[model samples]
Target: MSAQLPKIFITGATGLVGSALVTELLAKGHHLRALVRTSSAQLPGSVEQVVGELGQPVDLSDSQVVIHAAARVHVMQETTSDPLVEFRAVNVDATLALARQAIAAGVRRFVYISSIKVNGEGTEQGKPFKTNDVPAPADPYGISKMEAEQGLMALAKESDMEVVIIRPVLVYGPGVKANFRSMMNWLNKGIPLPLGRIDNKRSLVALDNLVDLIVTCAQHPAAANQTFLVSDGEDLSTTELLTRMSKALDRPARLLPVPAGLLELSGKLLGKDAVMQRLCGSLQVDISHTRDTLGWVPPVSVDSALRKTADHFLSTL
Candidate 1:
């Protein structure tokens, strides 16, 4: 007979990562509980819903593990008077509060889904971000994640509950939104974008690949109290990425050969220098440690993942 899977309590069950994780965990026969704001929130039939927000008291008494996937994600536009404070209210303070509750409830493991921004905004060419590097967060969102990581590490040292942190690069999949989806729309509409001739490598994790790693960290004995960086094990240039995306969407890519320098200048004048940097800059991550440490590998290939994403995008149209 097979052994029973550990009971898991999860946050952000309605978000991209959380929803996918919920499906994956349930498939593996793990009993699941989710924190939701409303009882009407849609989730899998097997998940037990607990209504509450972060920073509020929660009861994880029956759970053996906790996977914290919710966070105050990056804000492209600074709308708040104090963005850091707003981020900390949910990302750091609420995360720590949940950890304390998990500890008190005898939860054995806590898997945190962090971002690659905690490493830095960009990496030097050919010098990928590694697992052990001094964090240099450039924005308030990254800062809050780093602070939460630090707090969790301190808490782990004083408690029996193991803490596992996994920092993932840009995640794209069926339900992806924001810039990735916009790019797909531009390609599908045959928009002439001046993004060709740019040479920059970027690391991205597919939603499925990231979810696989998260589940691995949740149960792997070696994953206890360790931090990991994950990716699709393939790096692609901006031009290559666009080209692949075009192929996946079965659309023609009208990429003009615009120089990167000119694009940067235009972006600077328009107060979008940060946006241009992402297009023209490289941010690679070395996942050797993640591979060696836990014997983990991204189960999905980039092309396959992109094809899936494109299929979803087309289905929604």
Candidate 2:
């Protein structure tokens, strides 16, 4: 890195991934401008805030880097009649618009934060999804992400701007919400869960580790025009995850020894089959390419990250 780091313009400043990213970049002496739809938190007064939504165009002339972390993320229960159309408007159309604007502003690089679902829902045991494999997006949200990647690649081919795409699996850390947070809450409350018997391997990226990768790709010459799968490089089964989480929370894991098959059956009966699959599914990523190609290693250990997340969750109570 140069003594004079490049200015970075990032979207999703309030999100789980983006806020931490802003902090990391700032700590390394980089000036940052963040897009804030609402009053985004965790930023110091020195950082500039660009009040806007994803669909609007922004001035990226002074920025050498653009991190497009904002997107219409996956909705479990989509209310729209045509969800794909809604997803494309922001994820595909608006994202492409932003990339073109960045290119026009002579921004050197664009870092797109994509989802692992673009590679597919889950993989069979011992078979992890690689960045080189063909995409098999299983849902509207994943499909939209693939489309955005394709469009960005096309745009990059016709312009001087470099594009780096990152597809990450479940990202968990302090202040995480949704499923991972719910799991921590359940464990903290000693609520018994029927996931003790399920053996599933899932790759998770710590928030700090992912921020490191984002900053790495922001300027790394080797990372130009590359797509990578990111993880902590440590895979854990459902049972193991619960156990470690319990240890971090200083609570007992009240997981029952229920058969995976029986859990799946009950999930279908209760309209939670998808949730069950997520909790007991195998969704691992092979990050050897990331390590060999980018010379990047996750900066945070999974156990330590989990402990930090547990500490935060406990603090909220």
Question: Which candidate has the highest lDDT of all?
Answer: 1
Q: Which TM-score value belongs to model 2? A: 0.97
RMSD of each: 1.0, 1.3
Question: What ranges in model 1 sit over 4 Å off?
Answer: 1-3
Work out candidate 1's RMSD over C-alphas: 1.0
lDDT of 2 by residue, 31-56 (tens): 88988876555678878988877768
RMSD of 2: 1.3
lDDT score, residue 193, model 1? 95
- TM-score per prediction, in order, is 0.98, 0.97
Task: Give candidate 1's TM-score.
Answer: 0.98
Candidate 1 local accuracy as lDDT? 0.94
**lDDT score for candidate 2 against the true structure:** 0.91
The digit string of per-residue lDDT tens for model 1 on 1-317 reads 11468899999988999989998988888898999888844797778999999879998988999999999898877799999999999999999999999999999999999889899999988999999999999999999999999999999999999999999999999999999999999999999999998899999999999999999999999999999999999999899999999999999889999999999999999999889999999999999999999999899999999999999999999
Model 1: worst 10 consecutive residues (lDDT sum) = 1-10
